[model samples]
Target chain A: MAFEINGKTYETDEEGYLANLSDWNTDVAGRMATEDDCDLSENHWEVIKFLRDYYEEYQIAPAVRVLTKAIGKRLGKDKGNSKYLYELFPYGPAKQACKYAGLPKPTGCV
Target chain B: MKQIDWSSLVINESGKAVKKFMYVNRHAPHGTIYPLEGLEVVLIGAAFDQDVSMAFIGDGVFQLNKGQDTADSGMKNVALTYGALGDYEVTKLYVEQESLDERGLELNDLMNLTWEDEEENWAEKPSIQVVSRAQLSDLLEQQDVILNF
Candidate 1:
């Protein structure tokens, strides 16, 4: 699948994950979110930025359980819980947030 | 059907059986997929909350080499992923000293893998232990299951 913005085409997998992680930018993330009928909010950006930084360090998209714990440690208890994350990305925190973050579907994620 | 306490079966609560799972990585990190596949199994197994450890021997020792630049090679550099093993509770990593010596590698040649001890005020501790061939053999014998890649 592909999406176009400003005359450039962004390729994605069948599941809508970016084909090339390097192709991702804030604009790409914003466009992807818009496709899902979701708006770009500060809360959503926080999780997306966290996932990008995490993938940079670990070279893998963390599972939801791991993401939650790490977010709790870094962000705070209020923003780290599943409820808050789920509210931000309703499809599933790790799976949906990681797609917008331009990472491959998280390892071990169904 | 009755509700099963699955966590009780795998978790090491007192009186519950917890077996030692040793993943022996014996291949290079990039040439073949064995090392990556083995690491994935180790991570999944860690969720069971059993006694888990890993032994890096032969070409496997190269998996922990520091500053791996795979940008031009087209292969993903997964060396950084090893750093997260600590968070998965798979901390015990044994590196065969004989293997390192054969390759002219030193302890500093490998990545500094560590885990935080939540019980001890979150103190950081090293996870890799360099051991001799004999020592690794003895450790291998103690495992309930030894998975070799």
Candidate 2:
């Protein structure tokens, strides 16, 4: 599937994750969140940015447990746990945030 | 409703038994999927918390060569994933010296992989070790299970 923003087209998978990670931009992410009936906030952006940086370094989207631990290390305890992360992305942190971050679904996610 | 200790069903009275599991990789990383698939299996197996290790001989030695850029080739650069193995606690990566010598490669040609020693104040320690073929044979003999790819 594909979506257009101001005459620029972006390809996405059947599940709505961006087909080409490089095609992602703020507009693309915002458009995706809107489709899910979720508004993008500073808190959500923090997790999205973290996921992007992680995929850039690791070449794989991390599982939820790994993401939680890494977030605790880089962000803070208050923002690290599953409860806090779930509050930001209701569909599940790794699955939803990674999609918004233009990453493939995590390797271990069913 | 009662809560059962599920781990008790798997572990005997001797406590959890950790086996020496070795994955021997002898294939190139890009040409086929053996090495990549093997690495994924190794990562999954690590969850068992066994005494896991990997040995690289033959073409497998090339899997560790540095400066792997796959952007132009349109292939995923899984060489970078080797760096993450340390986090899985599969830290012992034994490379055969004879294999490297045959390919005219030196120890420096490989990536510098390391694991942190939580017991030693989280000190970084090298994970890759170059061993003679004979030494590798000895290691193979000691493993409770050996998987080859």
Candidate 3:
């Protein structure tokens, strides 16, 4: 699949995940969110940034439970629960958020 | 346009293409990665907007037993992950009744899972259902794809 932003076409896999990880940017995330009918908020960006950083450090998207615990440690308890993360990314924190963060889809039972 | 097998397309009431995917979990949790890995596949499958369901049979029913704490074991307590299935649009969790009976378990022994119904102003709905072994077998026949773990 492909989507256009500012007349530039970005390729995505069949599931809309970025075909090339390097092609990702805030604008790309914004476009993807728009297509999903979701408006990116500050809270969403926090999770996206956290996911990107987590992937950079560990080379993988943390599972939802792990993500919740880690975010709780870094951001605080209020934003760390699975419910809060789900509210931010209704699809999923590990899958949807990671996709927007420009990382490969997490493997194993995430 | 290229030829398309229009009849092969199955769309749900909401107008999204959907396939009936059933994830079978038959292994005990914490011992093997099947249950956890199976749930992962269920979540990812749900993201594709498919009609997804899960069945807990055999020793898998033990995965849902209540009051499970792994703090001492130093393992990531994944039992709570089952509660999040509804949030991922995977609300059809069928627990085999015979499996529970044989293991001396009850519905109340498992976590109470609920999902938000966006169409109903986000009203909460129950996600887990205890089905008889025969009923579960019928359900298995209806699935377009079955992922066994």
Candidate 4:
């Protein structure tokens, strides 16, 4: 699948994960959020930025549990809970947020 | 490790090409569903008659440590599932020696797993093998696919 932003088409897998990591941009993320039927809120951007930073360092998208703990440690207890995360990304924090972050799908049981 | 000529052994007994699959366990059993789910996948793969193996490295070795009692933890004792792998015909289990030594554990500290060899009139056979890091690396290189957990 492909999406257009500023006249440049960005490719993605069938599940909507970015086909090319280098193709990620703010516009692409906005488009993805729109496709997920979600409006990009400040809270959503916060999680997305955190996920991109984490993927940049670890080269892997963390599972939901690990992501929650890390977010709790870095952000705050209020923003760290799965309830709040799910409020932002109704599908799944790790799967959906990581897609917007243009990272690979997390492996393993998650 | 014996190096068999791949060209000479193209098809398996079922006339289908065999694929060597290595499942890498890098996390402990509990606190995460990796090892549990990894074992489930291995069982499913084995049912398809694939050449399946598991490598316990780093914290993954903790999954096989003996004297585990999950009663107090309120979690099911999933480690016992390792023993059933033999029945699934998924017997190749490699434990990294360096990982065990670093953690101050020996082979005796792990669960004694055995498999029934039907060809040998139901004789019991050990399923686990402790190998050096270099040996494990060689084994990893030979796998057609490696599923890291």
Q: Show model 3 residue runs off by greater than 4 Å.
A: A1-110, B1-9, B12-16
Candidate 1 regions exceeding 4 Å error are: B1-10, B13-17
Runs off by more than 4 Å, candidate 2? B1-19, B118-121
What is the C-alpha DockQ of each candidate? Answer: 0.58, 0.49, 0.07, 0.01
lDDT of 4 by residue, B25-95 (tens): 99988989998788767755665567889999999999999978787997767776676566567688999
For candidate 2, the lDDT comes to: 0.88
Cα displacement (Å) at residue B9, model 4: 3.6
Let me know the DockQ for model 4: 0.01
Candidate 2 has which clashing residue pairs, if any?
none
Instruction: Give lDDT tens digits, candidate 1, residues B36-144.
Output: 8998887767667689999999999999999988889977878889988877777899999999999999899999999978679568899999999999999998888
- Where's the lowest-lDDT run of ten residues in candidate 3 chain A? A54-63
Deviation from native of the Cα of residue B113 in model 4, angstroms: 0.7
* Candidate 3, backbone clash total: 0
i-RMSD per candidate, Å: 1.4, 1.9, 7.8, 13.3
Among residues 3 or more apart in sequence or in different chains, the pairs in candidate 3 whose N, CA or C atoms overlap within 3 Å are: none
Weakest 10 consecutive residues, lDDT, candidate 1 chain A? A64-73
Give the better candidate number (1 or 3) by TM-score. Answer: 1
Candidate 2 per-residue lDDT over residues A78-108, each given as its tens digit: 9989999998999999899999999999866
Q: Score residue A21 of candidate 4 by CA lDDT.
A: 83
Kindly report the docking quality category of candidate 2.
acceptable
- Sorted on lDDT, highest at the top, how do the candidates line up? 1, 2, 4, 3
Model 3 gets an lDDT of 0.81
